[model samples]
Target chain A: MNRITLEQANAVIAGAFAKAREMALKPLGVAVLDAGGHLIAWQRQDGASTGRLQLAVGKASGALFLGISSRKIGDMAGERPTFLASLAPIAPGGVVPAAGGVIVVDANGHAIGAVGISGDLSDKDEACTLAGIAAAGLTAQA
Target chain B: MNRITLEQANAVIAGAFAKAREMALKPLGVAVLDAGGHLIAWQRQDGASTGRLQLAVGKASGALFLGISSRKIGDMAGERPTFLASLAPIAPGGVVPAAGGVIVVDANGHAIGAVGISGDLSDKDEACTLAGIAAAGLTAQA
Candidate 1:
């Protein structure tokens, strides 16, 4: 299976944070996970709350576990909030079911992992992650 | 400057776990970092406890920041626990000042990164990490 490298993850973080800066968004927290849902890299801006880290990680985990962008998960949750709420108890890494989580895909179209960002409007966060993923020469399954 | 590749990091993990198994140690969590102290990879065995991940990363971070084996820092920490305790609040990635963290050295003798393992005794963890580093044809400063 294709895997996201640390260099790639670092590039993603740099690109995302750069966009966050240019857009004047709040301090952000970002996380990258491998295909197995294990953390590969994470960064929290100096002013970002510690909770942002967990939230970012949760979003990525939710995306990987559901095999879809977290925006989709969030939309699904809108119709069945209770059913989706139950997933956290059983889902790997406790799914967040929110926007800002995107799947990273390899050249062959395999989902390699995910990139998640926190500390902005959920849509804006998703946009930032896309920018980062693109910077790393990867595609986001949005 | 030679950077550790994801392939090398995966090889390190495989080597480390193989050593753990040969010695019949408990399930382990292992982490690798780049020279900049950014996480490169991490893994927690199926039966490992949740906290192992953080502990492993913490140990690696402590070693990377201090430019010394965590075993040496642990020894110093024992002599000054209160002073060592103060470091976490200000240190990068929060210091763990314990054994099981070793710096990965490149051919030029530069500290390229670090590897940390948690699960068994600290000494045993350190030994396993060293074995893994050797298997990857790298040296561990421990």
Candidate 2:
């Protein structure tokens, strides 16, 4: 299995921050998780709020845990709020069915990891996350 | 002041896992914290218990918050049980006051971060945490 590497994680984080800067978004926190749902790398911009890190981690790991984009999960969560709420406790990182999370696919089309962005509009966060994965030469399931 | 980088944290984790493998210790969980006591990195080896991650985080944060090794905290806790019991609620990460947490120091003798290990004997966990810091060419205040 191809696990996400630290260099790749760094590239993703740098790309996300660059996009955030270009878009004039607030200071963002980004987290990357390996295929096994373990944290590969994470960062918080100097002025980012305290909870952004955990939010990013939760989003990314939620995506990884579900093997789908968190946007899709959000839609599902909307339809089944009670079930989703119950599911959070059983999930490793706990679920946050939101738009900022995307699954990263490797060359073989395997879900290799996930990238999550926080501290901006959900759509903008998703854009930055996808851009980061693309910047690392990977594809995003967003 | 030098802040602990993701690269250094990765090195430390890798070194700790390598030592754990070398020593044939049980599956372990390790966590790294920044100078401000925020989580920087963490991993639970395959088959490690669910609680190990939180345990590692608490121990590391406890050490960082107190500016001393968790082993020392444990000793103090033994003597001042009531004080240590009261301290946990005041600490952000909820102090563990046990072995397996060590502060990482920079060349100028400033505390940079901390490493905490769990899922092994407390003494062995402390040994691995110190070994990981040393392997990364960082000093462990153990």
Using TM-score, give the best candidate's number.
Answer: 2
> A61, model 1: CA deviation in Å?
4.4
**Candidate 1 CAPRI classification by DockQ:** incorrect
TM-score of chain B of each: 0.95, 0.95
Each model's TM-score for chain A is: 0.95, 0.94
How close to the true structure is residue B103 of candidate 1, measured as C-alpha lDDT? Answer: 93
lDDT of 1: 0.82
Candidate 2 per-residue lDDT over residues A37-86, each given as its tens digit: 76666666655666777788788888888888888888999899997898
What would the per-residue lDDT of candidate 2 be over residues B1-142, giving only the tens digit for each residue? 4877666776788899889988999988888888888876666675676578678888898888888888999999989999889986799886787899998888777888889999889998988898889888888873
TM-score of chain A of 1: 0.95
Quote the lDDT for A60 in model 1: 93
Clashes of 2: 0
Task: Assess each prediction's global lDDT (C-alpha) against the native.
Answer: 0.82, 0.82
Q: Where is model 1 more than 4 Å wrong at Cα?
A: A1-58, A61-69, A73-142
What are the runs in model 2 whose C-alpha is more than 4 Å off?
A1-52, A61-68, A73-98, A102-142
RMSD for each of the candidates: 9.5, 5.3
